[model samples]
Target: MLAEERLAVILETVQQKRSVKVSELCNLLNASVSTVRRDISTLAEMGKLTKVHGGAIALSENFAAVEKDMEEKAHLFLKEKQAVAQYAASLLEDGDFVFLDAGTTTENMIGFLPKKDICFVTNGLFHAKKLAQRGFRVYIPGGEIKCSTEAIVGAECACTVARYHFTKSFLGTNGVSVSAGFSTHDVNEAQIKSAAIENSIQAFLLTDHSKFDQITSVTFAQLSQAQIITDRLPDAKYRSFTTVKEVL
Candidate 1:
């Protein structure tokens, strides 16, 4: 096919799917990787599409403005969340000082936690309660509890998290974008998440494949700052930004 035809096809595909991988375009256009990449670059330069690490995404990709409540999210990706949580929990060790973020995925990690000499600080009311029930020493910050997600957020939460030096932090994000990094809709929550990541020695983002290529209202942390643990990696380009572990 002609270069013009390839570019047209690429633009159409990105418009339809919001994102298209170079390899997928190669297969669709019956063109070489170099040809697809060049076409993507041309479109990006023309402001027709945004070129990501391994794919092209629509310039107007969707942003999540609202968060799903725990009950609504509990069953959305139950299996995938469990798998990712299991892997995250395995990283815990004796004498570790951990920070657990509030979200359905991070909450799933509670059951898999082993009995160990560990201390945890969390901003999730549900997470703190679960951890305490499991006989793990847990601390919860004093802050305004956002009922929608049952997470504590505000100046108090961010301030409390800043005081602790955590060995590891497991955080949840509403969206993960190549340009925007890890994001959430609420600025207050974002502040707390950012504070936790900054105060921790190592940070891990726990999310599912659905998060990639999406952005939210506020960015909490950059991609390079944290390792990612997900059920699957939809794009290879994400690995270049940080370490990504796929549980399944």
Candidate 2:
């Protein structure tokens, strides 16, 4: 096939799958690995896709710009997210004011919280609704809600978060690197997370192991500001930068 035709096919495959592996693309295109690699590289350079190890994912997969369906995110890391949420919930004390950031893993903690009189604030609409239904004092920051992530963010949300102080906060991120610290794909969400960290006395990051090596658009907080709660310990590369607590 001509280079132009091959590139068109590759782009179509990426759009359909949201991500594509080099080997898979090679098989589908009936082309040599080198040719497929070149196409991927060219497309990546043109800002059509992001090349990850062993594969290339559509650049739009990162955040709001892409349609990240909520049902798909809810199914990812199901068991691991639940375990991390339970572990985080165990750390909560009665009557403690808590801030919960928006993410599937952190949202899981809502199911495990005690049914008592405690102040709960969140930037996640789902979380706020769950907590309110449970009869807990829940506050949802005022802002525009991004449909893709169900996260409320913007200047209004940041201003609301600044007015309250929490005893502890639980946050989640799209990426967690030793050097990059906690990061997310959206700048507005990152700003909200930063505000949460500053307003809370103690902060804990709840994320799955998959986030450890990735890098996202905006860095929200440093490693020192929060302890990480995950199912497995991080590799040696991250050991020097932060403390990771492995939850069984």
Best by lDDT: 1
lDDT for residue 38 in candidate 2, whole number 0-100: 88
Total clashing pairs for each candidate: 0, 0
lDDT of every model, 2 decimals:
0.90, 0.83
Write model 1 residue lDDT over 102-158, tens digit each, in one string: 999999999999889989999889899889988999999999989999999999889
Where is the poorest 10-residue window by lDDT in model 1? 60-69
Q: Give the per-residue lDDT digits (tens) of candidate 2, residues 2-39.
A: 99999999998888776678999989989998889989
Q: What TM-score should be assigned to candidate 2?
A: 0.72
RMSD of 2: 9.7
Candidate 1 wrong stretches, greater than 4 Å:
1-57
For candidate 1, report its TM-score: 0.77
RMSD of each: 8.8, 9.7
